[model samples]
Each structure stands twice: as structure tokens, then as C-alpha cells.
Target chain A: MISLDIDKPRAGARVVVAMSGGVDSAVTAALVAEAGYDAVGVTLQLYDDGAASARKGACCAGQDIYDARRVADALGIPHYVLDYRTRFRESVMEPFAEAYVAGETPIPCVACNRTVKFRDLLGLARDLGADALATGHYVRRLPGPDGPELHRAVDADRDQSYFLFATSRDQLDYLRFPLGGMTKDAVRREAERRALPVAAKPDSQDICFVPNGGYARAVERLRPGAAEPGDIVDLDGRRLGGHDGTIAFTVGQRRGLKVGGTGEPLYVIRTEPEARRVVVGPRAALARSEIALGGLNWLAGAEPPCRPTPVQARIRSARPPAPATLHASADGTATVALDTPEHGVAPGQACVLYDGERVLGGGWIRRAVRP
Target chain B: MSARVYLDYNASAPVWPEAADAVDEAMRAGANASSIHAPGRAARARIEDARESVARLVGADPAGIVFTGGGTEANNQAIRCSGAERVLVSAIEHESVLSADEKAEILPVDPEGVVDPEALDRALAGDARSALVAVMLANNETGVIQPVARVAEIARRRGARVHCDAVQAAGKIPVDAASLGADSYALSAHKIGGPQGVGALVLRDPDAAGRLIHGGGQERGRRAGTENVAGVVGFGRAAGIVGERLEEFARLSALRDAMEAELHAVDPEAWTVGDRAPRLPNTSMTVMPGCESAAQVIAMDLDGIAVSAGSACSSGRIRLPYVLEAMGVDEAAAMCALRVSLGWWTTPDEIDRFVASWADLRRRTARRVA
Candidate 1:
């Protein structure tokens, strides 16, 4: 009974549903079809099957593509699988490896959504003459005074707005999210009600492209000889121990330092990739009052205020939005000062801003400054 | 405008009416060809009749026909069973032939996709040991005909066996196994309006046929398992009708040319591959300067016209045409290439519609790029 807010009449409008071989997407397609709109399912084969595992660079794993085709067959909709391996490798995978090699903890999913999903796949949907592209992302798009506004999902636990912070206004206009208001349980129940075969499929875990949760191995493969042996040092530049590589550590990591003699558990304060050194210190050194952001995307109706503005910001997917002050600049850069010092702030992680539940846009973290 | 216009005949031609009827009859008879009862004899008789029809179409002896699962299996059986110490294959062959022998030395091709005759001679001359020199009668992507007769002569002089995969050339042109002088030749049904799962590997000496499947005594012990009776019957029927239609197929070159000319008129940079070489009249692989073939294919498909960017493989992904690349086409033009092949049923109106839609798509892409 969900209505897609498209211009054409429901029966005449064409909606291209991006099926990711998951139960959520399968249910989204079924629901779109049940709503009397013409639905077409498309699955992107993002990586070469020979080089990827389920958790590795394959967004649409071979089995997942088959599952999506089966779901499309059950739904009686035309389905096509486009090969996007080249685009994904260039846009998502290469940048991801580069970010890690530069000693930053990167969120590849957000970049993937920004470039491959919304940008490329949305263009393909338009090329196919579809009115809009629908996905299973648990983020709501609400009609605002000016245009469609991106918002957090009704199910706070499953909200994916943090990953979709880079969706441009043009792309937002042509995208629809049907599961934005529904809970995960309700989606699984709907799948069961529709008799979809993937109803019992487990949720995809970790990064989709890191095989067996081995992100370090994935990075090493992408960048050969990137993990050279380096020095693990303390806050005063005293060598505590030797480590395999600076890439093996991230900001705020506390375990596996191998420096057992340190009185308190030493956490990684920062990593200097060029120097090949990981600087460790006491836990308090991990907290940062402000972080500079680059590649800022503004989703607010108006231009970003040049003056410092009060807002809630989320630095990572798991953390809730916190009180922060945003200072926008002429160049595409901004700095956010949190009301309370935040921990584990690392470069390359996204800093998404919000006004209550509505996303005002975000950017990649450039640097985290200690108080 | 919404009615689908299919122009990808080189990928798989539409099944002919008679072939369809033969398949339906075979399926309805419900008698296994291996059984010994009267109904089984009737099924066997149908298969034998089809074998003769296919043999006559290709100018080969009926006794040499060994039907396999499809074209890939046929090519594999021919090369794997040749008992040769080494393999020499052309760079422009279908994946079925190129991937058959992993260690096979690849013979290079010219700019028009024709195999270098001198290269083959050198390969055969250098390796005195007996080898299987495999080459296709025609390139699948570019439709460029190969000098199979001369290459086979060189191989024969050097005591190397030759295999001509005539899957793309058999029905498109005159394919005479004896004239080509190949020890073994492969043919597929689907490329010539027959059922998809049936193909034949014709051997000059029947005793040389190698068995890839070894279960049943079917295919005269040359292949195993029960015959795909319906598929074989359809292939036979398709072969029986294709001979008389060869002249008509040759005339389709005009349609393909007109389509190319119209494309050139729309985009001055449009160029055709293998135009200087003796190619199949039905195929035209054209490249427009700035248009990506994948985008063109999608745009054409949306307009209800079916074409392909390269050889349509099992994965349904459009790869840069290795055939074009081997022919010395640069990556930019290769990425922009689209293969628009015509068939016996392809009408003039369909070609016009495709040209119009393609020109519009080109303009749209150009504007977007600007």
C-alpha cells in the first residue's frame, strides 16, 4: 500500500529497483510491484567473481545475483544485471586502499553509495527510461518546502543516513526508499508473506569487500608492499616497540600494540604514514574537541552559513548525533567543535551533520584536533 | 516503436518455423533414440535423416558427423582428442576454441582480423612435433573470414592437424570441409536457426574422433549419454533449409551496408571493422567516436531494438571487443564499438528504426559530455 511519489500515474510510471540479493531489496521490489507500479529489477555485478569472496569486493556476490534473479522471477518483473566492475574498482576500491595507505580509516560504503550507487546506477536507471530508482537503504526521503529532504530512518537501529550523506540534490530527486519507515522485523515478515525465497537470508556483515574480516589483507593486496615494518612510539616520540606496518594500526586502537610493558593500555593516538610510525598514548589523548572536514556536501535548503552554527554531528555509523558547532568556510571546508570531546576521531571517516533527524549533509574528516 | 527488433543474429538466430515443428514433433514422440522398439527406430530414423541434412549443408560425409552437446564441446573434443603434442590457435577465435588448450601458442591476426598465414607457417615450421592448429572459419565479433584453406595446407605439410570451427561461418557462407582441408571441423545449431544445445564435430577420418563424455555408446561411441533427440532433429531441419537460403543471406550484406552508411551519415566518425576483408554480409561492427557501446546497447534496447557491444557471453557483461583489439583498434574506438548484425528476417524498416534511434542516442551522449 506504499505510494511512490513519482509524477506519472502509478500504473504508468516505471520504477527501477536495485536488487542487492538481500531480503530487504527483494521485499522492496515485491512491494513496488504490489503497489501497481511497473517495476524492473537491476543487480550490479560490482567485482569479478574469480577475485572476490562474499565478504570481499563483491557487492553482488555470484550467489546473491542468482538469488536476486530468482526473486525477480517470483515477482514477474524484468531483471537485468549490469557489470560495474570497472567503475567500482576505480571509484570505490582504489580510493579505499589509498585512504588506508595514507594512514586513514576509510568508510568505503559511503563512497560506494555516493559514486557507484547513486551516481552511476541512478544514471543507468534514467537511461533505461525509468521514472525513478528505488533502493532498500533504510533512509527516508521526505518532501520539504523546497524539495525532497533526506532524513534518518524510522528504525533508529537500522538508520543508514550516515552512509548516504553525499547524495546530491539531483540524485535525491530521482531516488525512492520504500523501507525507510519500516522496521527490519516488518520487512522480514513482509518477505515471508510474499513467499520470497531469500526471507531467511542473514544480513550481510562487516565491509562487503573485506574477505573474512581481513581488511589488512585486502589493503595489502590492493597496495603491494604497503605494510612495511615501522616503529610504534609513545606521545613523547620514545620508541615503545616495533610494528609490522603503520597501516596495521588506526587512530584509537587499543589492542595488539605488543608493547606489554606499558603501564596503562596504550591506545594508538595517531599514525604518521609518511614516517611509518604509530604514536601511542594514554586513552585520554584519543579525545578530540574539533575536527576539520573536506569535500563538504550541503543538503540544507540554503547555502551553508558562513558563521558558526549549532548542530548535531555523527562521526561514525554506530554513534548517535552529538551536539557540535559547525563553522563553514568559503572554500569547500568546515570545522566542527563537539560540546563534549569525542574519542576515536580519525581522518577519512565521514562527519555527517543533522538538524534533529533531518540530514543537513556531511564531509570526509581531514584532521582531528585535540583540546 | 515498442515492438522489439532483434538484430543480433551472430549471437543466436531465431529458430526457423520448420526447425520448431521438427523439435515439437520429436518432443511429442516421447521415444528415446537409444531404445530398440519400433518407436525408438522411428526416433533413430529422424536423427539419421537430420545427420544427412546437416552433412549435405556443409558438404561433408554423413558418416563423419558426431553430434555433441554444443559448439564448445565440439571444439574441445576436436582439439583435446587430436593426440597432438602442442596446439596453435588463432587470437581471434571464439572463447570455446581459444580456451580449449591453455598452453596453445596464439597465432596473431592482421588489422582486419585475418590470421597471419606466415605466422602460422612459422609456428608449424618451428615445432617439428605434431600439433593441433585450431582456427575458426570466421571471426564471431568482426565476421572477418580466415584463410582456412591455405592455413590448413601449411599445417598438413608440417604434419599438424587442423580444426576449423565453422560455427559462425557454416550457414552464413559456403562451408565445405573437404575444400577447407581441415582434419576436423566444428558446427553449432543455434547460430544458424537451429536449437541451441546441439552441435556436430565433423571429422575427415571418423576414427580420429575423441570422446569427451565416456558413459554411453551413443554417438557411435564417439560421445556419451542419450542423444538430445529433439535438439538434433531441430538442427537437422535447420540445416536442411539453410542451403537454399544461402543466396538470400548473401543479399543481406546490402542491408548491413545501408545501415552502416546511415550511421556514417549521422556521425561522420563512424567506422566499420573488417570492411576491407571478406566478411559475413550479415554482420556490421560499427564504432562511433564518443559513444560507449554499453550505453548505446541500453538506449537501443529501450527503443525496442536489440544489438550487442561484443560477443554475447554467458555473463551478459559487455567487454571491450578482443576481436577489435586484436585487429589494432585503439581502446577508445573499441569501447565505442557496437555490433549490429542482420538476419534473414531482418527487414529494411527495422534497420531504419535502429539508425534513427542510434543517431539520437549519439547526439544525446555528445551533448551530455559537452
Candidate 2:
């Protein structure tokens, strides 16, 4: 467990805090300032979608940037809004669409962190001649002999290490997570204690660029001709019905199928992009024992053992990490065998590996295998 | 600080040394301008002298200059005083004019943001009673000078008064109220090289029935309350200095043209707004397609040069440039509008620095897409 020395102040060190116009980031910046660092708040203008960002409460967009500027003004620190819309489109939005088209569910938050938040922002911090890049993420960084080590937050319910497995060692060295040692309640309490304007603001649930939770609609807007009508089929290759597009369907989605009752609830089992078809079955067919992972970024410097290394794997962000054994291949891919069968293992979903609270790494799920 | 390049002069300019000195001199006085004592008369003399200087700058009688807190208050007072059952304004006027009320009719601008005198003629010709024609002398976004004379003639023929928000035009160009035929003209101090918190409303006739702020008799009771003595002194000094530096502004205009040429060479799609119409000498608004203005501003800021997306007042909130959109530019092109304004303090080296920094930013941003 990592412990924070709250009483000791780290004086004179220049830290760049990423203020996203939320209570957590605001409190984190206030704490950093209170801790006696030369804190400079930076907000990234991720997109110029005009009213969409304001309506969705997206960080570093439209009105949120104003809130960040106000917080910085109140704190008497220099604030800046860095534009990252191009990077966001290339890194996060494109990959999200490609993943959906590949018949897998994708987690854009990981891509945002890896591309925009960490890489480009860290480069900006370096340009500003700051010592470290700080954020309000609910994850901790402990100073190790070799470098800073990443761990989950003190609040297990709010631990975000799973989404941060793609962070590189270089990025981690210049990173500081100010809210790591505090629970969500404690952070909120401190925000209230400091009288931050966003103390009671609700956390954002939907992806920032995708307004109204319409990811398929956003993709359609971005790529107008790609979303074509396709066929819905069963595992036995029997045609069921017509689908709008394979990208609109993900594993385990039930609603919007438009298929009448088969007396049993149908769940999406798989999607085939080549055939432009979605395969559905009963609830029993959704269970999977093994998942193939790709695009693996290992944060621990070396790959895990090939002979089913025992670890805890979190298939989704909200779910708890279940016991699993990961088998690494000679290629940069791994097969995770859950100790207990897990349901709704989507192909594009991320499989994050953790040892207790420390994040080992994670990769995108390529395919789920039945026992 | 690597020879600081200031391109956001439209936001708030550096106080001219003459203005700063005048402000310092005015603050040393020991009496309020409103008192009946000798010291008060001395302060009053200073206030009247500043008023004359401001009137001379805008070609108005000294009696017409009614001082207010600043440009915003000046605009608010002028726009609210149109005393009409219905208010009509150009679509490209500043937010101070646009945010008045729902009853205010926003007159549309053509593709070049030129308010069609015929349109105003039609609107005024239709509404005979209680109609106020409000159009800015120059747009804050594109710096395109409107045909206020034509608008005023058209309004007068229909028995309506014209109010021109000339805050962006007053010191940048040759502003003569008599020639423009505007009933009321608004001027702010800080848009030029003067102090903030002081401005003036030049009325065609001081006896016009309108009082935005009522208090202790000040500005001949047209605007009430104590005068911002130091700020007024600074404004007067700035107006006098700008009168002398008008030629310098022309020189800056040439530099602005050069900058535009370089930018267009880099991207032929780069277009300037109101290039065909009359505009402020030192103002140029360029549209860089597929590039966000806020991003360019940020990139320029990181490079230690200051620029803006449109107006600095609304920079933090990303919004479409309403003026450009009104001019028939699509929303996508409007988002890419970047306003780079030069001032008396802008040096040729500073312009060169901006060009180099912009080139670097363009290359770096281009790489990200590739």
C-alpha cells in the first residue's frame, strides 16, 4: 500500500496540474498549491464542437475551459488551454470507430489518456519547464528507487489504475496523481472545505465527443458512407433479421435488436464485419472462459510468464477484478483464462492486469473463447 | 522574455506613456471634480480639458462627450437609450449590443458583413414609430467598417435615430461623428493605449432625453456620479497621441498586409474578411481552413507570443464567430477564423516573430495530422 505524507510540504517544485473544470481536479490543484508547489493549471481544448461540449459537461471543452480559467484565476496561477482536437481525432476517435467496425467494443478513455492526456500534455509540461505533470486521476504514484510506481487510489471503489495501464514508464516518471491517497468522499470534502464551485458537479458518464450516448450516430457523422445495412444471423449461420450496421451492435446488447420474442431473451454473441452480420443467442451462450488480448502495453518492464501467470483481471471498468491466469505468447499477445467464467466478454473490451493495487498493464480483447 | 510579441492589442493595449503620465498627474490632485472649492474647479478644468480632447478625436462638440465607466457601460447606455418600441442592430455588433433583450431585432449583414442600407431602409420604412437603428461603425470581429453614413441617412429619412458602437473604430481609423451622421457614438479608452474603466458617449444633441446612470450631477447631468478623473485624463492623452500617430497606424496597416500575404502564400485558402470593404488600418481577420482558432491561439501562447481567437473577452468559451457566420461563411469556416490585430506598439520585428512562430506552429500541427 502506498502512503501519502500529507503533513510534509514539497516546496519550490514546479508542477503542472491538469485542471478539467471538475471538483476533483479543482481540489487537486488547490491541494497542490497548498502543498507549496509552483502550480500552473493547464486545460486541454480537446475539441471545438461548440455547444456539444458544454451540454455534455466534457472536460477541457467549451464552458469547462472557462471554469478552469476561473479556478486558476481564483488560485492566482497561470492557466492555459492547449488545443488537442487533432490528436484526439486521430488517436481516440479514429481508433474507437475502427474498433467498432472490427466488431469489438472499445474503451476510448484509455486511448485518451495514452495519447492526449499523458503524451502530448507531458510534452507541453516539458516545454513549460515544469518538473512534473499532475492530474486529478483517482490513482496514486509512489516514488520508487528506479522510478515512480503506479498504484490504485486509497478508495478502492474509485480506483482508476485499470484504465491507466497504457501509461509508459517515461510518462509515469514525470507524473503526479494528487488525489491518489484520498477517497472520493475525502476529495469532495476537501473541495467543499476549499469552497470550489464544482464541488457538487456530477461526474461525466458518456464519452465527451459522443453526445447523447450516440456513439453510432457520431461515427456515422464522421464516416458518412461506412454505416451500411447488414444482416443479423445466428451461430448456426441462419439469417435472423437485418441490422443497421455491425458497428451499432456490441457483445451482450439486447435492446434495439428489433427482433420479436423467441420466448428467450437474445444477446449479441458475436459480430462479423466481413459478412456484415451480428450473431445472437441465449444468455448461456454469452459466457466465455478465455479472451485473446492485443496491443498489450506492459508497464512492469517485462512480459509476464507464458505458463498462465496468476493475476487479477478487470474486464470492464466498473466491475471488480476477477481472479485469472494469463498465458503470454511469443508474439505480443496474451490469453487470459478467468478462474471463474465471466459473462459479456466483448472483443474490443480491455483486459487490465493488476497485482493487488499496482497496474501491471492491459490490452484490447481480440476474441473470447468458450471452454 | 525573448522580445515579447503582443498581438492581442485588441483585448487591452499597453497604456501609452503620455496617458500614463497624465493619469499620474491627475491622481496627485487633492480635490474631487464635483466640489465647489477652488481645488474642485481645478479638477473640473482637468476633466473638461479631457472631454475636449476626446471630442476633438471623434469630431464632436465638447458638450456631446458624456463620460461613463467604460466601453461596456457606454455601449449598454447607448443601446438601451434608443427609446424605440423596437430596436434594430447589425448582426455583427459586439455582445454588449446583442445581449440586450429578445425584443431587439438583429439586422442581418451581407456576405462581407456590410449592413445593406437598403435592408435598414426597408426595416425603418416599414416601422414608422419608435424604431432605433443601431449599427457599429466597425465590427470587432472583422474590423470591417460599416457604411454608417448611408445607414444614418436611411434611418433619418424614416424619422429614426442611429447609434454607432465605434469602440473598435474610434482610435484605429479616422472617426468623425459629423461625417458619419450617427446620433450617438460609443468610444472606450482601453481599446486604444489608455486606461480601462473610462469611456464616452458622444451624442449628436446633448439635450437628447436619456439617462443611463442617475446620481450626483456629473457630465452636465447626462451621466451622473463621480468621474473617473485619472482614467479620463488617460483617455484624453491617448486620444491626442492617437491623433498624432495616425500615420503610424497606416504603416502598421502595410505590415498587416505583408503578414496576410505571407500567410496566404503558405495556405492559398487563407482569406481575409472585409478585404474589399473599408476596415480599420491595423486590423486583419484571417480564416485558416480546417484549423481551430483557439488552438492556434494556444500554440502561439506556448511560443511566448500573445494572439487571440476572436475577442479576448470571449476567448475562454469556444463559440462560433457569429460575425463571420452572418457573413455567409459556414460554421466550419467560422470556427477557423483568427483575428490578428496590430497596434502602435507593434514593431516590424514583432510581426516577423509572429510569422516565424505561426510557421512553426503550422508545421508542428501539420505533423500531428500526418
Candidate 3:
């Protein structure tokens, strides 16, 4: 049986595979069915970008849904497309826009994985009589002493544990990630072996709702006039240049500043959305060794450790985890003290703490303080 | 797979053996009806015979029937190309009819799922341009039969035309387009025991039916594409055979009534939409307490039974059927709505099995919630 840690007999167990029309999830569905379990593929229509949808002038399903259905048909599994546009807007898109308008560079993917894809889908899976819900995420749910533990995927390069730290313990128990151990090449090869049509399909990049990675346009559409003209100031608060919209710039962003007269390359130290000021300075100003976090999902246990917990802290999705000490409180908040100074520790980004490969807990970066 | 009970006939009835045989025969010896050859003449005769059967089913003359791609096309033909400058469709109409034009003024419906003739009267009052009023004979979601006759009368009094979408009502109940006092009625064969992709527009003046699609002299210029000959024959065969089994619908209605009663017994709060109003005999749109329609449908499918809710979403997403919303049902209750529509072949034992499974599901759900 394609093994999941669900507490049911594999022969008759029904698993709802959240198919994303990507090669990884397609293989996950195939593996579950091969293991003698009833696998049902469910693809959520998260967004309807008219061009990608099966159009008839309604809240339509995008091309991803069609791809998922085709994969399900090939694997001989029952498939369902769920309309989640409203839920997605409420849980992920709205907060993301609000964050941008508040002068923060938000990682909406973490918001999605923690809310719509896990919290709500877990409820739906149980309601559908599924023993467990499986997804294509490249994170592992390992059996722990107390319960299931979220861990990094075996193929470190494809690991998504950094973005999945907000998954609660109970949610981790009900969730299964079958592609956690497989590399990108291995998953594509498996898809080819299973005769999946998406074997050669390219990986989806950037924010999903941001078509063609045009974040500025997406933000403008979601929050109109978010790109209003603003003043670019140095660390001393002297106006250096005028720019359009605080939404276009991010903390520690090097390019697109458009204030070329400065002799040395300048990085965005911070953005004051209320004042409509873009603070530019030397790259050193972006450094931070102390980080305050909020909304922690402490997966190791019911409560945070009383003493400081040594861990590896990851401040961004693209960055590697660095050595740090976590001081978590009972109020769903924490402080990650990095051993060495880290650069570009921006607010609204996820701060994931890891013990080796195991994800201990994580929270959203509320503020970053320089050493 | 075990023996399954298909309770989603309103979605599309199981094609009858007679219809299948007719479709097969027509496909085997395919020919263009416009040709002068013997094979062509034979095909034309078959099409005409099918048209007569469809006309008889709707109580219209054969000349009033114009075959189209499907019920959607027929609806578009009746609602869009009617030469009316203003179109007003009922709020609870099928998406195909509702999407004909975005500028269409919506006519309201009462709590009983009936279109308000008074509201239609108000909307049509003092309209300078010619107008068309489109309302369904029976809603596909709630199975509530609208007062299309009263609506037609209101339209006539206001010097406007009326079009009836009788796709869901024709087989489940007796439907006569001529008696409904409408300018045209849209019908689909698949809603009965016929094949998909075949439907007809029955108009008071058949010559007015082909305005949506323009081409050759086919369908008397009401429709101009090459005919779906096999589909047409199947539709006719199903229509001809269904008339003999009208009494079976009465029996199925009894089964449906018992099923709803069993549902209420399972969960006291559960209720069927439009229970006090006239509805299709085969359909029972029940609200399963504390459950969403999508979850209920998926669970039922897993239990080897087929039921449905929501409209025809080719994309397969489950959205709350707007019919109940139009009837002023709250969003929560609307999400809980489930439609169980029986086919002519549905047996009493199958109904019992459905009830048993439903009771088990309800118990499990209630226990979980508690």
C-alpha cells in the first residue's frame, strides 16, 4: 500500500489527494491508488484569471483544474473541483494585499498552506469521509514521540518545510506529503512512469495569483492606488528622489530604487507606508540579529519550552536556515536570536525554526532588530 | 463496484435502451437530410418522425419544433434572438438562460419558489421597447414549478413576450407548451431518457427559432448546422417511449415522498425545498442538517449512490444552487441542499437503500457534531 500514517486499514482507506495539476501531486495520487487505497483527487479553483479558465462568464475553473482531471482520469481515480475563490480571498489574498499596503513584503504561500490548504481542507477531508488528506507539498510528517512531526523533505533542495511551519500538530497528523522524499527529477520520472501528461510541464513560479510574476500589477488590482508616488529618503531622512508607490519596493531590495546618484549601492532599510517614504541606506542597515515573531504554531508540543531553545532560523523562503536561539512565550509569540547577523530580515515574512531537519515551530516576522 | 442507485436523473437521465438502439441505427446509416438521394430521403423521414415525437411530447405541432445543439442553444435562441430590445429573466433561471445577456432585468421569486407575477407586471409597466420575459417551467435545483402560465399572462397583458425553459419538467411531469401560453419553450432530450447534445426549441412561429445560428436552409433556417441525426433520433425514441410510462412518474413521486419523510425522521430539522408548492415528481431537494451539499454529494457517491446539487458546472466546482437563494433561503441552508431525482427505472428497493444509507450518514454526522 502506498503508505500514509493514517490510523486505518489501508485496504479500504479513502485518501483525498489535493491535486494541483502539477506532476508532484499527480504522482502522489498514483502512489496512493497503487497501494490499494481509494484515492480521490480534489483540485481547488483558488483563483480565476480569465485567460487560464474554462470560460463561460462565471467563477470558472482554471487550466490547472483541467490538468488535474486529466491526471485523475489517467490514474483511474474519481476527481472533484472545488470552488474556493471566496475562502482563498478571505484567508490569503486579502491579508497579502493588506500587508503590502502596510509596507511589508508578505509571503502569501505560507498563508495559503497554513489556512485554506490545511485548516479548511482538513475539515473538508473529514467531512468527505477521507481517512487522511494527502498533498503535493515537499514536507514530511514523521511519527514523533507525542504525535506526528513536520520535517524537511529528504531532497533538501525541494524541501518546503520553511513555508509549512505554521501547520498545527493536529493538522500535521491528518496531512500526508508523499513527495517529501522525492527529488524534482525523481517526481518527474515517476510522472513519466505513470504516463502523466504533466511530466514535462514546467514548474509554476512566483506568487500564484500574480500572473507572470507581475507583483506590482496584482497589488494594484487588489489594492488600487497602492502604487502612489512616494519620497525616497536616506537613513538621515533627507529626500533623495521621488518614486511611484511604496508597493513597488521591499526591505533589502537592491534593484529598482531608481535613485541612481548615490555613489554606493543602497538597499531599502525600511518603508513607511503611512508617510509614503522609502528608507534607503547602506546594505549594513538591513542586517538584523534579533527577530520578534507572532502567531507561532509550536509543533513540538502543546506549549513552548521554558528555556531558550537552540535552533536554525530561516527568515526567507530562498535563504538557508542559520543557527539561532528561540525564546518562545505562552502567548503564541516568540523571539529568534540569531548567532550571527542576518541580512534582510523583513516583517510579514515567515521565521521558521528548525532542529536539524525537523521543524520545531515558526511564526510571522513582526519586527527585526539590528544587533 | 456494488449495485448503485442513481438518484441524479435530473442531472441527466440514464439513456434508455430504446433511445440507444435508435441512436445506433441512425449512426450506422448516416446521411444528410438535405440530399435528394434515397438514403437522404430515409434520413429526412427519420428526423421528421423524431420531430413529431418531440412535438407530441410538448403538445406542439411538428412544424413548431426546431432542433438545436442542446437546451442551452434553444434557450439562447428564444431569449437572445427574439428581436426584443429588452429581456427580463427570472432570478432563479438556469445559467444558460441567465447568461444570455448581462443587461437582463431580473424578475423576483416568492419564498415558495414561484416567480412573482406582480413583480413582472411592475417591470413590464410602461416599457416603450418590445420585451421578452424568460422563466423556467420548473427549477432544476429545487424542482419548484414556477407559475409560467401566470407569468405569460402578465407578459401578454403588458405587451411583452414570454419564453419557458421546460427542460426539467417535460419528463417528470406532463408539459404542454401550447397550454402554457408562452411564445416559445426550450427543451433538452438528455433531461429525459434520451442522448445528450440534442434539444429543440418549440416556438409559436417555428420560423422565428433559427435567429441565433445563421447558415444554410436547414431547420427551416431556425438552425443551419448539419443535423445531429443520431442524437435527434434518440431524442425522438425517448420522447415516444416516455409517454407510455407517465403513470410510472406517479409511482416515483410516492417513492420520493417517502424518501423525504425518512430524511426528516433521520434529522428532524431536515426539510425539502418547495414541499408546499408544485414540483417535479422525481425530484426532492432536501436540506441535510449541519452538512454542506458538496460534502453530502461526495459522501453519497462514496456510499455507491448518486445525488446532485448545484448547477451544471462543466468545470466540476460545486457552487450553491442559486435557485434556493432566489427563493430567499439563507446561505447556510442553501449550502445544505441536496437533490435526489429518480429515473423511470428507479425501483422501490433502490429508494429504501438510499434512505438507509442516508440515515447512517446522518447519525454519523450528528454524533461527530455532538
lDDT for every model? 0.89, 0.81, 0.88
Residue B50 lDDT in candidate 1: 92
* Candidates 1 onward: DockQ, in order: 0.39, 0.09, 0.63
Model 3 regions more than 4 Å off: A52-56, B363-370
Deviation in angstroms for B278 in model 3? 0.8
**How would the candidate models be sorted by DockQ, starting from the highest?**
3, 1, 2
Which of candidates 2 and 3 reaches a greater lDDT?
3
Per-residue lDDT of model 2, residues B1-370, tens digit only: 4967898777778899989999998999858999999989898999999999999999999998998998877778887865778788889888777765456887888888798888888887766587778899988878788999999998888888888998988888888999999899889999889999999889999877378898877888888888888899999999998977777787787899899899888778778888888778778888777666765676577567888777654356445577888899888788777888889888889988888877765665555545
The prediction achieving the highest DockQ against the true structure is 3
Question: What lDDT tens digits, residue by residue, belong to model 3 across residues B97-124?
Answer: 9998889999998888888999999988
Instruction: Tell me the tens digit of each residue's lDDT in model 3 across A1-371.
Output: 35897667786788999999888898999999888788988888888776755555665666788899999999888998877788899999999999999988899998998899987777778877788999998988888899889889988888999888888888888899998978988889999987898888889888889989777788898988788898999999999998888888888998998888878999999999999999999988888999999998889988989799899999998899999999988888889999988888999999998999899989999988778
lDDT of 1 by residue, A1-371 (tens): 99989878998888999999999999999999999998989898887664345333223347788899899999998777777778899999999999999999999999899899998888777655678899999999999998999999999999999999999998999999999999999999999998898999999987887866777888998999999988999999999999988878888888879887867879999999999999999989999999899988998865788889999999988889999999988788999999999888889899999999999989999998779
Looking at model 3 chain A, report the run of 10 residues with the lowest lDDT sum. A52-61
Candidate 2 lDDT tens digits, A146-168? 55778888999888887898888
The candidates, ranked best first by TM-score, are 3, 1, 2
User: Which of the numbered candidates is closest to the native, going by highest TM-score?
Assistant: 3
Native contacts retained, all candidates in order: 0.23, 0.03, 0.54
In candidate 1 chain A, what residue range of length 10 has the lowest lDDT sum? A51-60
Q: What is the lDDT of residue A82 in candidate 3?
A: 76
